[model samples]
Target chain A: MTDARILTEALRDPATVAQLDAAGWTALLAIARAEQLIGTLAHRLAGLPMPSAAARVLEDARASAEQGRIAALWEAEMARRALAPTGMPVILLKGTAYAAAGLAAGTGRAIGDLDILVPRARLEEAEAVLLQAGWEWVKPDPYDDLYYRRWMHELPPLIHRERDRMIDVHHTILPLTARVTPDADALIADSVVLENGLRILAPHDMLCHAAAHLFADGDLAGGLRNLWDIHCLAGEHGIAGVEARAVHHGLEAAVGRALRLADRLYGGGLRYGQGRDRDMLYLRRLLARDDWGRPTRKLTRLGFYVRSHWLRMPPALLAQHLFTKWRKTAAQ
Target chain B: MRHATTLRIGPVGFRVGSDWRAPIAALNDLYRDYPQPDDGIPDFNVHLFAARPWRRVLRPSVHIGGDFVIPDAAPLPLVQGLLAAEMGMNLQMALGQRRYLLLHASAVERDGRALLMTGMSGAGKSTLAALLMAAGWRLMGDEFALLDPVTGLIHGFPRLISLKNEAIGVIERALPRARFGPRLEGTPKGTIRHLVPDARAISVMAEPAAPRLILFPSYGFAAAERAVLPSETFVRLTQASTNYVALAERGFGALTGLVRRVPARALDYPDTATVLEQVERMWSAG
Candidate 1:
């Protein structure tokens, strides 16, 4: 077994440790190092409440602090490029927010470069602007640029020609293939600008984005953290009317899934406990299984389906998946 | 007001009353609530609501009621000094999150390309920024320079170049015309205040400009000295940056791509005067 398994068992109790072989103990020490780092981050998060889910979500942040640093540099470069006698507005996303939110050194996720979303109308102009500022098109391979331009949801990624920092300029959150759309202009119109003159997505929109990310992709690799983000947003913003809109977007199942995750993984004294306890008994059966068990995969796939329930348009969609998977296989 | 000014970053919402209220309210009134409603506040903007107790909030866009407590035992000298440090950091976060493409370095633009002087704390970055600003290099923020993610152009947020005691005198003599606020006493950075450059007052917030050369400057006490390093040195310099590792996955490849496209060099200078001369030479050659 891998170190992850060994440590999980060893951390349980003295009896669990005693039951392990020497190999298991070796794995246990490695796990202990990871745990020590996580524990340190947790200690930092404890000082700040109200985000509700922040403390638990950051448990693994220390492991990913390096990623956060790269993201921040690119973010700074983007802002610098926009400076004017009257600077234009800009906004940051994800990992940048992790550190900016003052959880620095504790934000564990590694971000390659800053990811940004500007108005679609400004796309070409934005690219030109970056070029004018000494950022160059790094796509020596024309195919890569074409792939990003035609297939992906955002522009080809960019890097600072001199500083060597990277940036991803996006107009939307998910890929066009995912076929999810949120009103971009509407988000821009509703954005709140900071003293620095950059605008960021609002609370409702941020929550929707996180939930949509969870459901549209059905990739739960970051599931626990994403759910925690949603829960914290709700708790801090008050869930009062979020559930209805979430349901309208076909996100009720995702919300339920996220809540179930919080209940199962976080364990005891959770902030999202209100009105969600009723779903636990049903969800427990869904969650109980080994990693390789068919039950777990089936349950996970079901959650993915429920989250992507909005993709029910045109019954001919079944042909699309076959063609798409075939295309992916061919490309590889 | 508490509910209104609270914003979220990551999993937390920083509120104003106990943390960031005053500045948010002030900015809200100044900006007419956000023109775009869907794009709510980002988590990177910091607001100082109460002066005493020095209650301030950081990245208060999505959540509320969070506070940044600089430990009571920590070594802080000036009340505004803490604010400046917090603001310096948060300003970059705001720019980065908003796609301003801000960077952690000392910048001064000559011709179209910006000569970035970079290094971590005590590497003499802030001192260089202040010295250049005083020497009429036009300010682009002392702690960080904002770049446009798309164009790589840099902007200037020329407020003040924070300085300690000795550098204050060094800058004062370097440019006698430099304006300054009253010295802020009692802080960790050792009785600091802003050295306001004449350029900061009159410069038209300067639009984002291209960076022609990446110069990683190292200061020493040896006799006046200067050397130009290889372009590949930028990778090491870029790696030395605080946030480079954070953006590696999605943006790191791009950053590497950026360095490949630009000319980079390391400069070892004994003092600010030598730095300015080399900067002039690099841009002139460009």
Candidate 2:
């Protein structure tokens, strides 16, 4: 693997650590920590003889990651308690799902805001119930609220009034206007119920949802982590299961592309060709480094930013949305 | 901004990069006694970048960024870039630190036991801490008290005491010969100055101390002292902590353990001299 791709390789197999020096380990730790993959790094690199500075950082990362996992579970419990009375079967999503379900991906995973999915029909009821239970709209802007409600996948994110924790309540995975629209009801139907009565998207469906989130729904800003999710999920359920489910759910191309990307970047596989390899390398550069580390030049980030918007909405609506957002900023 | 430098304060390390050279020179001059990050690894990063192109060339304003960044943070003028770098480092630790439970407090140590003090702004914690250091108590830190959740010991941070407003003059008069950073006038905190911790504090920063006493000091009050109930102490400490909520259970355990084991008091005094006397009395009583 080239320098950009080595970090991912190291994450997958701890044995790759022997090739690194103090400087290399230092840089890798910074990059991993910044990407919120340090827990996974620390876990993978466990028992390896390394510099004390790197070891201390890994220790800190492991501690933080464990705290995040515990906090993620606690947040899930709180949401279950809050929404249980409304009788909405709260479907956990993404990192929170991985944590709540105790999947391999959950181990050493750093969690951010809690994300949950409910039936679009019951979204309003869930919102009201959550509001009564002390969650308030984070963005009070009328236009932003209109945009999210009408076009986007989630509610204008709600934050706990007291805890200052954020929750993203989604009715679907992608925006309504996106090119691919998976059957969200089918997803809800196939969810696996956890012991505590929380529903998580089934394993195969979980992979598809993660793929849709990375390649279909949002910008690949954090594609490394999301793709690592694919890597972990695929490793556990087998690529064949995820690929088969992808074909069943009209996401074969997205899932295949995600798998190929993750594989080509980390594994010694020929799933993807050279022309696309360069782009993935550029993306890997952006994702592997700390914020102050190496960057994916302004033009490349701008390209992805624009491409993300393009993939999100149709060209015409995209223009109007960007203009309105810019105008709002100007007015402010 | 072209020059980059690395400095380590106690356990944490920082690499500061800037687009303007003034902030770098200021950091170099002010942080002369601090150890260079020679292990070739820094735990945190601070970048002082021009918020705008024009801001870099004329009437420069710096935007703070690093591993843990807060976008849209207000920009600071070039003169205050040192403060921006310090603030950026502090912000990263507050948001991203995981090795220890972080409390917004100042502490001083004697006989291997630490005296931790916390209060709201203008409460004279910094002043009282500087005074304590002058009276032979080793300054642990002025900004953060790093608490080990496992060992229940307080690790020394020993950062420069950022004396603000009237406290600057008060500390200068109390320690007539102590070294001070350039007097920065008209800051948001009004005439800010950095007082370098004594040589012993810097050298012995790696030592850890068990917390002996906790005080909630209030400045400019009629002479009054009260015992802080454990419940009040716990709540106030939680509120005073930077990472208490983020660290979750680990934080709860560390804080509750401290409040239970350490004695606490609320001190209300009219001036630093009286507070110093009260603190000494409290220490003796403890």
Candidate 3:
């Protein structure tokens, strides 16, 4: 079995850690860390017997995860306060949403930025309010700024000067130029309000958002964590009305591929038809790490890098965007 | 990873792997006196790998990676592989160590009491700690002082003392018989040479000592001394710490307890001889 598969197996069944030797634990920890799932793995294998070294590393992981959770929630609160004057109900998305709602998918998850969905009408007002509240534009380059304003789902990312944490103010799930456009207004309308008055997507919408993020978004650099989220959300909410919701949003294909891959990796007994060769290639791209945690299959990674851009924009726009980015990097 | 080795330093253990054998060989020789980890397992893993297949042979740049990494860190040439390994291990500790309140300080223990000297790099803390070790004080650590939040004691992490540039000449002259690693020139930190602490330091490394004095020493300055207020010490220490914010409440408690219990002073001197005398006077007065 591949070293990446060892990580998947351990995540599926934490009890398998008991049978792993020193080298097994080493490779497993390295892979889990490389995939940014060490905290989730630490949560899964918390009570299991393991080597002292592994225990120490996981103990640190759990602590760091707790720190991330605190930081994530704090950033959300800060954003809520900043946008309070706008009188808009801020819909939390992805990791922050799962965390604020106390979902299983968020337990020990390493969250990076604060993502919120607001009405597209108030995008300008929200950006102005956040800028006044010490969030400056992260992208100073005018071309990239223009690109984000025109074609991206989120505003140019804003970073708090004092706290140094980034907040991605997203209007919708997918970019405007993407092939699949999830109904943003419907998403905001269907969001469930938490005790703190912040909102999160309902179960089915949440699943669809996770699926879209995994399949329709950027290169699958962090595919394992995204798939882990899918597995947890599907297990808790079940795949009952998710298909209908995804179909309504034109994301059924992405959602279907996500569920099939999650089940294959984590063994939930959810069966689907034979996955396409392209989907299998995605799986290979996700599992392209060696035993020592170095990324192998360079050509496959490059292919997916191109494919991610292709999925986001049309061929003409893709060529233009790639050339612009390549020129900028080369000039540097 | 083609060559690997593991060693325990005080409360922490490290398993270092490398694509080339020279770095591991250097580590094995320098850490010969250090004990292996308790169960043939290490608390952290450090890997030195090439960015690409051809880079491993041509130019042979070694990128420092492990459980944690600083992406975009410039690669080191293969001849400086030892420096890369050392940096990789230090990087893991700085980023991943949450078990202790890590202070970017150097520490030494004498008479069952630890003296911690913390400041910016080139502030002479490392050189002072090395000189003290030669003067019969136990060298706790030179890079980081691991403060146990629960026990409120300073644990020893007597890895190699990284002597930089001019400090190398001072230490070599002071401890004429001390074992030294290869003198690596043109590193990011100018020239650096590693000094293995005396056998006594390694033999008693696991012992933790109650911190008795804190000093902020500055080199290349006029001889002057001033008491540092706890409030200012708290802020400066926070800035000096890499993991203070991550440790959160436990870190606050430990640091507050430390400032309340221990008196701190900032010492500036024109030369090492003057600082040695000042330290001796302060040690007796305390």
Candidate 4:
């Protein structure tokens, strides 16, 4: 078997890690790092015996993930304080939400930017308040700013000047030009409120958002982390009405593909039917990492990059966007 | 990766891989005295690769990549591939190291105790540490000082001493027989050279020392010394640390205990001789 399969097999059954040798553990660590799932893997294999080197790396991963969790939660609280006067319920999304709700998906999760979903009507207000709270626009270019304002789901990524942490104020889950249009209002309406007056998407909606994020938005870079999220979410809150909720968001196919891939990779006892050939391609793209953590299969990566843009925008706009980006690079 | 090597520097082990042979060859030569990691497994992997396919052979530029990377770091010319590999290893420690409280300071040991010198870049800490090592103190590290939180002791990470611009000449004059890497000119940090630590530093690299004195040194100034209070020292050390916040409470406790246990002073001097005298005076006084 190929070295890449070692990561998949280990993730499917953490007990198999005990049987791994020094080389096996090295490959597993590298692949987990490449996939940005080292923290998740560390959590999965917390008690199992492994080599001392692997144990040290995993211990570091666990600590780093805890740091991420603390930072993510603190960012959410700061956003809440900033938006309190605006009277809009602050709805956290993705990693921040998982952390605030203390879900299993959040355990040992590595979070980057703080992703929050605000009402579309209150987006301008949210932007103003965040600015008042010392958040500045990261993309200063007028053209990129205009593009984000017109076509993106989030604000042009505001970063706290003093803290150096970024907060993405997303009005919806998907981009405005994407083919799949999730109901932003229903997402806010169905959000479950926390004890601290913060809100997170309900279980089914959270799963649907994770699926759409994996299959519809990105080019499957860091897809394993998203799949692990789905696996954990499904294990904690079963995928009972996730299909119907995904259909409501025009993301049923993406949700189905995500679940099947997650099950295939993590072996959660969800008996989904056989995935399509295209689903296999997605899996291949996700697993196209070599034992040394270098990316393999350039053709597959490029194909998915183009496909992600295609899913996000129409051909004409996509061409214009690509041209603008190419020009920017050339100028640089 | 066409060529690769593993090196254990103090507590951290690194597996360095390069697309070209020159960097790995240089590393093998420079680190020939160092030991390999236990079981041949590395804590971090450093990859020196070409940004593009043709770039590997055409005016080759080496991009630093590894488990953790700074995405916007500009590539260095292939001639500076050794510098790139060193930066890659440092980058991993700065971003991924959670085992210790990493201080952006230079350190040396004397009589089983450690003396830490920290300041902004171009502050002469590296030169001071190198000169002290030449003057009979054991070199602990030049780039980072690893503070073990549990034991409240500093671990020796005596990697190659990175001497920049003017300090190169000063060190070359002090230790004429010392081994040095090839002079890399016109690099980002300006004419750089790496000095191999003496045999004693490498032989006792595993030993941890109690920090007895902390100095904030600045060069190109009139000779002056001021005692830094514990509160101010705490804040300054936090700014001097890369992983202070990542280690969270353990880091806070370690740093707090260090400042309370050890006295600190800020020293400003006009030249190396004056700084050396001031350091000795402060050491005896402490």
Candidate 5:
């Protein structure tokens, strides 16, 4: 069947849009008229990364008379939430901050859930306030619940009862495993509150988190985005004491690993840190190799294989995680 | 197969597998060809892609794919098309963020706050998100809004808002400079593209704003006047949200808070211009 036919049949299930191929997408965009592209880009701003097509469209609409209205709503909501009785300290992480902060604007990486880190003591109270306002738990699986309660530092996903937006509230990050425990508490304690009343992790901790997350993934798939986030955060926030702090916390290795992946994938293109320049070059060389068909061999060798070992354990621990994961799955 | 192993949306693809290799390969291709960057592709994030035989389903898998580069394929005319669809809804799950839940919905922003436009198939949500964005609203996303459960903040991933028919022309007339990528005639959504979101919206691209409003928009071109519903009523109106069941408890709490904190409304407008004016007023209210 023709690519169009395949896509047509797929659209029969709107869910199919989630599975479009690359070439299919190019052809699809090529045919869209100027205006239609704008509308589509607006709707998908949260679903995918920003591309030139969508960016161009957005440029033309900036001066539209409607901008002030939307901006007003955003400001008011920020104020209202601050007034809530349970108006706990919240930090807007990742893209949420990036958009407001004006870093990496327009890249389409759909934000699935709004992530907030609240103190564990305030977890119940926060959940209660949200429920009263219209937030609902998205999952009820006991295993999943246990995983979040135990291994994870957050709760199961929550969605807006009416608006359908998903959210994840957290008190900490990462499991308490030996590999991740050292920096967890420090991250929470050192977080910085934004003008919006949300307390986000410090740049050092945030970059470390991104690093750990990328390593856990085993490939450079998220390497570029994560690298960019780190670069921007470091550049914007300044690595002033980041190197010393990262070392003190023993997370320097994690940061190094992430930087290596980024250099290999993006060639250390964006602006970043002075302290990290050496590490960045080392990482670049580590990842640099002959680019074959997909760079699969090089990518796999970069970090996935070694990192997989970090999450591994002896039979007993292995059983524990598996059993824990299985039970969580069962509960869900 | 009980269901297709992969799901395609526009030019994105999502797959779930325990074996690792196949899903990894599939995801690599998906990410390689996707028109923009993302956190869900193979290289985007680490997911527990497993093939355990848990008869009792837990942790769901969500896949979104559109045109990833496909070489040697015969030329065909189309906008954006979905080649397949696969999702393991209501499964036990977690992502790298370790702090938020991901939902399937199109998030559009206005001002500094986000207004989630959610609905099922043919609800005109993608079209609506596109239209509003063209009218000067920020595009948080076309599908999936990553929300922080504690703060109810919305993250913006500005990319093309894929559209089908009627909505296409609707956006065209609203913003003359908008550019489309391509068009495929046979797809259900008619032609699709890496749609151009409003320039201003893109400018403020990755901001996370507190969600102020939840509007369930059902297209009725015949309506002569704009209708605003109470936030409470709008709460009940969104029962059609796909992830409501899975995320019901948390979703309910967040939605209720948003309505009480902000204002929830159901918007019914005949054209893009009217919708823009009505939404603008709602956004302006404190």
Candidate 6:
């Protein structure tokens, strides 16, 4: 295993923290920050008599994470109130959902932007309602807006004109051009309403969505945090529940891969530490090393950047999109 | 990227890494009087690297990077690398710091009590705080006055006094023996220079001071003063603080406690002398 794997293991181990010096603490914090797990680290290491230097960093992380959580909740509330006019069932996804549902995954996660999945048919109605309620297009570029509207699973990103907050309203999890299209209807239909009048994806579907996010959509930028979310959800749903849910969504292989990677990275020295060595090596190579959690010089981010784009779209569209992007950048 | 140095100012320790030796050398010279952190571990890290590899040799701009970053911030030329480092450090603290309610103010101490003066930009708070320091008042800080959330005690962070424009010349003449950085001209913020804080301030940076006076100073005005009601002061302070909203309820309670106990006065002064006199009078009364 690499230093990141060691740091990942140590993240939950108090005994390991005791042995870490300044350099170790610095590396761990940077890795955790890059992975968006610093808050989780802060939460886990709360009781230990942490050194002032390390403790101060965690304090800062915890404060930032807390602020993000609060802002996310506030944005969700605003979105809920805005969507009420259309009477659309606005199901919160990812961080916002975890937070609204009081899930363990929400504890220290710093949600970047608000993500809410609405019914595909209601997408236009939801967009109009949000617009009238103050959300404006974040990407005002005509081509970009058109690209998102025509080819993407979600509308172009919206920013609350008054609050300056950005939110992504998705009709489905994966992009429309992606190879694997999960049944958005099932996920949306299974959403459970919370006491706060907000809706969240059901336990099994939540696990499936997290797996899909890691394997299908993202470039594994914050893969560790995403895995932690999966870990937390899996713990709540139990292994059988997660397996059944993934099987139902046709994401059993993706879920298994994520679980294996998690075991390799975070669950060593435990009963579930029997991840395949070959899988670990391949997954590690594919992940971007320039990310905060990665420090290995041999692994270049350029390799995975293209791969993520390829995974999100087909070859012809990807080639055309890349060309257009290159031309635009060159012109600028 | 190799020239690096670690130094501590008050409670905060910083590891400043630079691609060019110039910035690191300059920081070392300027901060020689200040002590390094007891432990080598830094509270914050600042990386001053060139934006592009070609930029490292051609035009050579210093781009700030670290644990906390504003991705779109413009790069600074090599000549102003030290300033870039300082700005980067300040940026990280302002954005990342959570243990304290950070106030965008200048501070000075007298008899274990701190005088925090905050106002709009060009308010002359920095200049007044420097003048007070010259008058034997211990300068607690200039850029940020950190108020501990639990105790409400002000931590001393007497970083290099960033005197700009005419304020640079003002301090240059005021203290002949004072150490000052090179007179940098024609940059982002007009002519700029830095003044090394007094050694006394450096030695006593660890000592926390109870805030005794809160002054909302307005420079270039008719010399007049008015008492700020606690309720009004709280609202104004919440605005003055950079991390008040981020810290949420703890910040609210800390600011609330400080405003209630500390007598706040809005001092509109034409010059620094009047402000100094008003501050001295307030301190004496306390």
User: lDDT by residue for model 4 over A1-332, one digit each (tens)?
Assistant: 34366777877788998787766777788788877788888998998987777888899899888988987898899999999899897889999999989999898888999999999999999999999999999999999999999999999999999899999999999999999899989999999999988899989899999999999999998888898899989999998888888889999998888899989888886635567888778888988887678888899999999899999999999999999999999999
Which structure is stronger by TM-score: 1 or 6?
Answer: 6
Q: Can you tell me which runs of candidate 3 are displaced by over 4 Å? A: A271-274, A277-279
Q: How would you encode candidate 6's per-residue C-alpha lDDT over B1-286 as one tens digit per residue?
A: 3688889888888888887999999999999988776456777778898766788889999998777889798888999998999998898787778888999999999889999999887888778878888899899988889999888899978899888898877777777789899887877888889888898898898899999998998988888888999999998888888889889888989998998899998988887667778778877876
Error of 5 at A140 (Å): 2.1
Query: In candidate 1, which residue ranges exceed 4 Å CA deviation?
Result: A1-74, A83-88, A103-110, A136-144, A244-256, A267-332, B1-286
**How good is the docking of model 2, by CAPRI class?**
medium
Q: Candidates ranked by DockQ, best first? A: 3, 4, 2, 6, 1, 5
- How many backbone clashes can be found in candidate 4? 0
Please state the CAPRI-style docking class of candidate 1.
Answer: incorrect
User: For model 3, how does the per-residue alpha-carbon lDDT over A187-276 read when each residue is reduced to its tens digit?
Assistant: 989889999889999998999998899889878888989999999999988888787888899998988899899998987955344677
Model 4's chain B yields a TM-score of 0.98
Candidate 4, A225: how far from true, in Å?
Answer: 0.3
- In model 6, the Cα lDDT at residue B91 comes to 87
Q: State the lDDT at A75 in candidate 6.
A: 93
Evaluated at residue A104, the lDDT of candidate 6 is 85
Model 4 chain B scores worst on lDDT over the 10 consecutive residues at B36-45
**Candidate 2 or 4, higher lDDT?**
4
lDDT of 5 by residue, B110-131 (tens): 5577887665667677777877
**Global Cα RMSD, each model:** 22.1, 2.7, 1.7, 2.0, 16.9, 2.8
- Write candidate 2's Cα lDDT for B20-74 as tens digits: 8888888888788888553667887778897666889898888888778877788
**For model 3, what is the error of residue A83's alpha carbon versus the real structure, in angstroms, after optimal superposition?**
1.1
How does chain A of candidate 3 score by TM-score against the true chain A?
Answer: 0.97
| Best of the candidates, DockQ | 3
What tens-digit string does per-residue lDDT give for candidate 1 at A1-332? 13233333332222444454433332333233333322333333344432223222343244335544554744665655553332444555555544444333224434446666777767777777777887777776675687667655578978877768677777776655555455666656666654455556665666666766665654343443455455455555655565665564555555555554544443322323345564553333323332111123456446556545335223354356456657867999
Chain B TM-score, one value per candidate, order as shown:
0.65, 0.97, 0.99, 0.98, 0.59, 0.97
lDDT of 3 by residue, B1-286 (tens): 6899989998888889988899999999999999987566677889898877788889899999988888888889998999998899889889888999999999999999999999988899889999999888899999899999989999988989999999999999999999999999999999999999999999999999999999999999999999999998999999988889889988999999888888999999899888889999999998
Using Cα atoms with residue i matched to residue i, what is each candidate's TM-score against the true structure? 0.40, 0.93, 0.96, 0.95, 0.42, 0.92
